[model samples]
Target chain A: MVSGALLFQSLILGLLLGGLYALLAAGLTLYFGIMRVVMLAHAAFIILSAYLAWWFSSVTGLDPMISLVGSVPLFYGIGYLLHRYLLSRLRPTTMTMMSVLLTFGIALAIEGLLGLVWTGTQRRINLPYGPTSISFLGAQIPVVQIISFGLAALSLGVLYLIMKRTQFGRSLRATIQHGQAAQLVGIDTTKVAGMGFGLGLATAAIGGAALSLQATIYPSLHWHWIGPLMAIIVVGGLGSIPGAAIAALALGTIRVLLEIPMGPTWAQTIFYVALFLTLMLRPQGFFGGRLAQRF
Target chain B: MPNDSEVRTAVAPPGSTAVARLRSLGSGRTGPLVGIVVVIAVLATWPLLAANPYMLSAGVIVLNFAVFATAWNLMGGLTGYVSLGHIAFFGLGSYGTGLAVIHLGINSFVAVLLAAIVVGLISLLVGWAALRVRGASFVIVTIAIVLVLLLVFQSWRSVTGGSSGLVVPRPFPDMLRPEHHRVFFYIFLGLLALVLVSYLVVDRSRLGQALKAIREDEDKAQSLGIPTALLKLAAFGISCFLTAIAGGVYALWFGDLDPIFQFDVVLSSQIALMALLGGVRYLFGPLVGAIIVGSALEYFLLNFGETQFHLVATGLLLVAVVLFAPDGVLALGAALIRRLGPSATSIREMSAADVRAQQDERAAARGAGAGGSVTEEPSERASDD
Candidate 1:
């Protein structure tokens, strides 16, 4: 019999971690949805944003949260340019393979650049409320985690709105649903694809800011996150944001809960195992069934 | 049949049989075999020519990677599986050899053989599980295997020595001095030659044709009654066997085993990158890639040990190669020669064009067949029209 308090704490912690994972997967799924390119550099971009946040906070004596205001748009423009100039030129038949290689190369370059600039030393955002905890339903929760969770929720909400309410959203959805039809219907798919990629990167900036608040980060920390992120997006169902978000939560919970019985090191294996099993058993994913035959 | 002959004529061109035969003599089966022999002969006598320990040691390391990359190409290059978890087998072999020599008190050669068989079985299992998925999913599964193995090895401290790693007894301790680098260099060269020979034999066999067919279209190949899954597993097993041998040799030479270095994703990525950089489809691609990448890495590390400039350079090289020269350095070189040299038209280009045309025709025929099937149900409408 597990103690009520331990279960409660695990639940809260899991949800919080999951919330952040959802934000990360949101960007990845969006990219996959629009471009049919698995952006392996997603975690690298997140780490890059974290570094940016760290630098901004250090230089201006401001909270890392403020870095998102500038970083998101900047990342958006970068993503747009990357798609327009480099990614768009690839043949559709070879896009998956080539994109993986291209993104992996980009990830390597970014990691190397980060190492050159800041060295391999781990860095975390030192917040005033870092050590402080809030008493929530008799459980002590870190203030930074609560804030990170809140930020993740807010960004996800905004993403949902952007993906549903706006005209651009409709066009993006149409293009994702049926590229040829959308093209025939006068949707400039190329433009939508570029913007969609930009939106994905903008979310990465937000996720990065949240990640900075949650944990210690280094240049190569992306390696640790890549497997889990891939797992979350894949489990959530490649292009489905809500599905990804839900899967992220479940996986995050499962991961944290596994730590109770299996120890921390083994807890890290849960996502990878989950990813492998999911790919084997249900390659279309939970929300990806409709889109499976098309891909 | 007439169309087939016309296509062949178009691909080969007239009045070029003599030149084609000469080119074949230089590049065909006999050519590469002779080339390999000549290179080996030169390398074998290198110690007599100049017994440079440093150069010989570097050469050994380069050849070791060449063997690994060639093993990887057996599956990745030929079958298009692109497994990123090959380091798992390498690590397993390292540990297997290390454990056998240390605990079982076996000779290094026996340990190597034992490790190869073990890794081959493991590859069969892994290939069965992972190869069910296609494209990116397959890649992800392969990476996951490496990550899982890395964690398992790291945590199983009692057996694997965990993160601190295990130290193995070196084979031939009396001859372990730097002066004996020549012997190890020859050993690595022989291993590389063996790997290349295996690749050649496989590439020439019916099994190779089946593997290539699976690479082209699994569904079509399956429809034609090809045993794709079994062939893939076999290919993966062979690939793993060669890689494990290399790993065993590395274990005996290096005398230490660590999960981080042995099962490193970086090392796996480097192997894949080198294969692609040299040209994966070509038999000699990995060897060329290993020589270039391994030498460049050694030079950079020697000069800039403190910095990760080499990784950046590698990344740039990868991006450039993937984008501009997906067919690889060999193809790029051939293209350049054809464009700039006396030959206005090359056999490679002609054949490439012919292949593309054939593919287009097949696709058109398939489309028409589908149309015919759909129209078959409209017999009454056709009569009314």
Candidate 2:
């Protein structure tokens, strides 16, 4: 039998990791919801933001969190321009295939640029609170993880407000549900699409900042994250933010629990296996309702 | 749109010997056949003319990539199911051959064949499970499969040698000499030729037509009783079999199989990108793409000592190709040729006829199958949207 303390610790850690995963997957699902395009470069953009955070911290001797002031808007503009100019032009019939290829190309370009700028060496943000921990219920938790988890929850909460309370949010939801009807209601879906894409990238800034605090950063680390992020979104039900967030937490917990028995290397396989099994059993996903078209 | 003379020619009254002779001369197959012969002649003599180990080795690598790209195109290009994880089969083949030779004490040729059969069966199973999902989900599943396999191969130290990798025994241990590169180069060339010929044959068969139908509109194809799932599985299996053969040859030629490189997602992307760059619809597209991209990659790696600048170049090229020349560079070349040719209008009309013929064939197929009227709605909706 497992010790209560270890189980509690794993549960806490898993919850925190899941929060971060939710943050990462939120942008991807949002993009998919609005544009019906799988932004494969989503992980690459996160890595780029992480690198920006790392560079900002090193140069200014400030915390990586402070760098979000610059990174968020920068990535937002990039996303805006990407959708406004390039992705918007693709025909809907071929958009799925073309977007994948286009985003994959962009991912490669970003990876190459990152490699050229910083090399491929792994780096992590060395904050003063990195090692500091607090005991709760006789289990120690790292302060950085708590902060990262808090940041994820805070950003997700803000995103929820924006998606629910605002006029733009209503229009975004309308467009996602029924584009033709949304346009008929004067939603200006093209504009909403561009802004929605920007909002997705904006989340990457905070997500990356939180990620640096939790994991080692590198140019190619995006490759490792892509599978898990994809799993979270897919398992949560594509285009459902709440579903993605909850699935992220559940998957995160499952991953940690698997790690206990299967070792760390095999732990990474849990989500991929989950992704496959989920795709096989329910392509519509757990929360995916009418969106599940028969193949 | 046909003129009176054109209609008469097409109708071709019985015993029109002269028109038949003229039509045979103008058949599209002759040009490609001549091009293939010229390409083969040049490749067959390259080793004799250059006679260098480096050149021969480079040729072998290029040809291996050509084969890989062609095999990938069989599924991705023809069937419109972009598999980002095709390297799984490649990695499997590499390990299968290496393990068989090292433990089972089999010859390389037999090992390669064994690996192909093994991979083919695995693909059959994978296709059955994975092909049920369409579009983005299918892509994600493919990627997941590769990731899972990479982890499994990395952790299974007893069989795969883990991350440290496995070394394969040379195919011809007693014939280790300077000419070995030449021999392997020819062997790689032979494999490339085999896949190329297979593609050519399939491109003309009912299977190719079925695959194209699926690519255009899978739902519509299914409505027309095309059995889209079975055909897709067949394409996936054939693709896996051919790619596995290349990987087996690669295992022997490279001499060491590492999971990191063998199961690399980047390699899989490169194969797909090369096929796309060369023009997936064209028979010789992947070969052309592989030669250019593979050579450029080798040159950059040699000069810059492993920087990813080459990848940036490749990415830019991919973006440009997708945006401007989605049909591929060869199509661009053909268009330019037609534009500058003396009989530009005649060439345009001829191409128009070709398109009409293809549409007519598809229409005939649809008419013969179930839910004929349903197919038209999707096509109209696609254009309308």
Candidate 3:
């Protein structure tokens, strides 16, 4: 007999976890939507941002949110250059092979560099609201969890607005839909691709900022996130933002629920097993059709 | 009915038709078969020439990777699936052998066979589910499958020991080190030979042609009644079976099984690098690539010393190779070698008119490549038509 309060607590935790998942999945979906290149290195970039946040918080007492002010812009520049200068040159056949190798190389480089600088120790940021709690209904919810979910929703809302109302967003969508047609209409595809990449990386920065709250981060955290992140993207349907959010929530809920009965180890396998089954049944994906429209 | 292999063989070289080339390459052809037999004979006797333990150990490593890489090449290079989760098969094999020896008290030979079969069955299941998706989806699914397997190995502590890892004691504790190593080395070499012969047979056979057709155009192959699904599953099973056997050999050589060591991403990435750096389309691509990259990196680390720069150099080398030589170093080096000594090169240069005719022939092949009716283009989810 699970109490209403206990169920409420799980829901709150799932919501918070979903926010973090959405933040990671959004970037991945955006990259896939625009370029059709699965940025396998996206997880590494998130880990990199987390390490940077940890460094800033430790060194200057700057908050994780404040650290993103610098990291997001820096990552934006890096992503743009990486897409334009490095990745854009390859043809599809070569691109498919090179992206994996290149991303693995990038992941290794990030890990090697982080090792040189920070060593293998896991780092965490201490927030003032780290232990604070808020009363909701009959149960107490953590302040960090509330803030995490709120921030994730607020940022996603802004992203939705930008994609819906902005001219750049329209052009970005156009480029994704048909590059040749978009070019014929005088849209600068290269710029659109670069901006799309930048937007993806920026989301990673935001995610990194949010994720450093609950989890201890090391360079190897990249590996841990990659599996779940891919699952989220698949379930949400590749390139669909709303699909990603819904999928993240669904997955997070399943994971949290499974954790209670099956143990964490089995729960981890359950998510992947579910994802594998989902792909087998619906190869085009759950949200792929809606996503095709945005593209 | 002749398939593109025949066309590729026939038109690929002048003074030789596809049938003639196939025959020459030892698939019933006279000339290439004899030459290939001679090469095999020479290679088989090479161990006797290099009797040093150090050399023998190095040879063992080479043979081990050569077998693993060849296994990888089928799914990754030849079939164009590019699996990143191949170490799952390897890990399964290690665990199978280790479990058999410890729990079931099985003989080593029997254990190897069981491991291979287990891995093959697992691969068949994964392929049946995963091959439904195209392109990057297949890659992602394979990786996820491996990740799930890794989690199982880590979490199933009673059976797998979680992070602490499982150890399998050597079956023969009394054997001398060099003698034991030599026997294992010979075993691996024999495995390598069997794998190569199998690869050659498949590569020259009708199924090989069908697999390539599917890779080139799945829809077209499906329309032509090639059974793309079954072919992919078959390829996956075969590839995984060989990889698992190699892993079993690794377990026997090391006398232990560790999840972290056996099923690591590094193993997966290394196989991929080996397959690509050699030449995916070539039969010996992985071996060539592994020997070049592996020996070079080892030399650099050992002789010139080690630093973070070694990793940085490796990363840079990968970038450089992808950017400058998408076709692999073998192709690029052959071109350079030809330019340097065109007169003495094994490949004969065609006359200008012949070259023009060859270009025309290639354009026709390209037309066939592009002209074949299949929705090679990804379906636009929004487009109604």
Candidate 4:
């Protein structure tokens, strides 16, 4: 039942996809880390970005990579404006529950808008070199997969640099660790929160581009993505970046590997299974409490 | 994402005491009773009165969602576990009844009841495992419940009929096609009435009080000798059971079980919002929310033809409710009624000083919200009958 080479291929593909998943989840964790808001709109935004990418490349005749230059900042600004105008106004005591409600609403609106605009028909990007594959340890790896993986890595690296080295990163982390204490120390937690939300949304642009390259896209595809992404966050631990990243890669690999035996339909369940098992045994998440103490 | 050290923002919520006082300038007890009577009369007469089929069917859909929102409130409003996946039971009911009817050749009515009981029993097991984790974990666990079932129902093609879905045989074959809406409307309205009466019973019972205490602060209730876990599980079971019955009835009436629509998280969220929009703390919160939201949805579909504006409308309403009326529209209505209507009832209008005192009390509650002694927070539900 277990073929070695196929398993290796599954592993490689799973890891590549996982890298992008990590990027997608990074924004969710960032928002949660700073504001304790489980932004359900994150998934819908990714779907929105994917459509943006599709429209951009189709109209401009440029690579989707080029589309990201415009989309990333555009999404970031939207997130920034959203936080400044709307989310910032919610009371701290009820922010978590309220944000979940608000974001779900936003997500629905976005989904409906996308459906109206895109007509709910499925579409995928056509990279000239998308179908070509390269030999990796005698297992064929798609060129797009390699490039997307590279993109995800570069984005993640920049994210890590911003989180670890920048003054903003310090403030963000401080707020995540203790918001009141951060404010007491004169950190503009509000501004940081807005920017953090923007940064989180900014990733959606890249994630959308990455997702469009790999999968079939539709207006309601966000629902499919949200479940696995949620599983990743839960297994990774709330508000923990490294934890989410690690969980994404592991679960993503398992999900792809499961495809061989379980078929794509059944394998899609791997995320929920991982989530259920994790919730039963380790509700705080694998990297939540013990591994490298959450920020 | 449980953050205990959240900074209390300086911004006052839009529906603060100031708004309540302004609203109290119009709020009352008899007003809602009168409103309920008007609603019942309107609903009862609508089917009998000369009307087109479209309006009649809309009424049925509204009642369907009304039942869902009310069932969802049994746990979400009362026990404060906002489950986004409660619709999983609804979906299971669809499949369970469909499969039972088609495979076992059982009577449709019997299948409906059987499916509900089976789903309720399943919920107890699921709730036992899920209730172990609270807050965000519980949310994810519930989502996982739906996701896993989606996979099972989707991949298990032999049993569930998969994406192709099962066609449930519609009951009352003797009735004509146009008569379906009229019959189901009465069925759902009667169902709604039963659910409302049950809600009132729970609201007045010891269990309801304990549940409200749990909502206020679960750990405090647990230490005060309330069986927190068991009660949550029980509430979750009942919530699932009722939701399943609604779904089963829907299956029997509609005769389709598409996993996508049945297990929809968006629909579940919408149900959750309906409850929240009405005032989850109040006994009639779900019914009020259901009527408002359900009618609004129907209006959206009617006005914005050939577009998905209804989804956008639902989204906007959810946002507006969370932002401006977090305590719900009924609470605001009650506030207004207290202001304008004569105080024939025992309800007293809250003064500015009383509002200030209440704000301080809520602030103290927030302090207890994060870290507290394992103790009880008394349930003082905002009044409604």
Model 4 residue runs over 4 Å out of place are: A290-295, B1-42, B342-385
Which candidate leads the pack in TM-score? 2
Q: Which residue segments of model 3 deviate by more than 4 Å?
A: A1-3, A290-295, B1-59, B296-315, B343-385
**Cand. 2 Cα-lDDT:** 0.84
Interface RMSD of each: 1.9, 1.8, 3.8, 3.0
The number of the candidate with the highest lDDT is 2
lDDT of 1 by residue, B38-98 (tens): 7667767756765567767777788888999999999999887777788889889989999
Best of the two (2, 4) by DockQ: 2
Scored by lDDT, model 1 comes in at 0.84
Q: Docking quality tier of candidate 2?
A: medium
Per-residue lDDT of B267 in model 3: 57
lDDT of each: 0.84, 0.84, 0.76, 0.82
| Candidate 1: residue B42 lDDT (0-100) | 72
Write model 4 residue lDDT over B1-385, tens digit each, in one string.
0111111111223456976545543554223334444655577786877378888888788888888998898898888788989889999887888889888899997998999999999999889878877765677667777777877887788887789988888878788756998988888887776565456556545788899898888778989999988888888998899999899888988888888778888788889998999999876788778888888877877788757777778888888998999989889999999777777243444454465567557756865786664222321232221
Query: Model 4, A13-122: lDDT tens per residue?
Result: 99998999999999988888877777888999999998998888888878888889899999999999989988988987667667878888899999889988878788
DockQ, every prediction: 0.37, 0.50, 0.33, 0.43
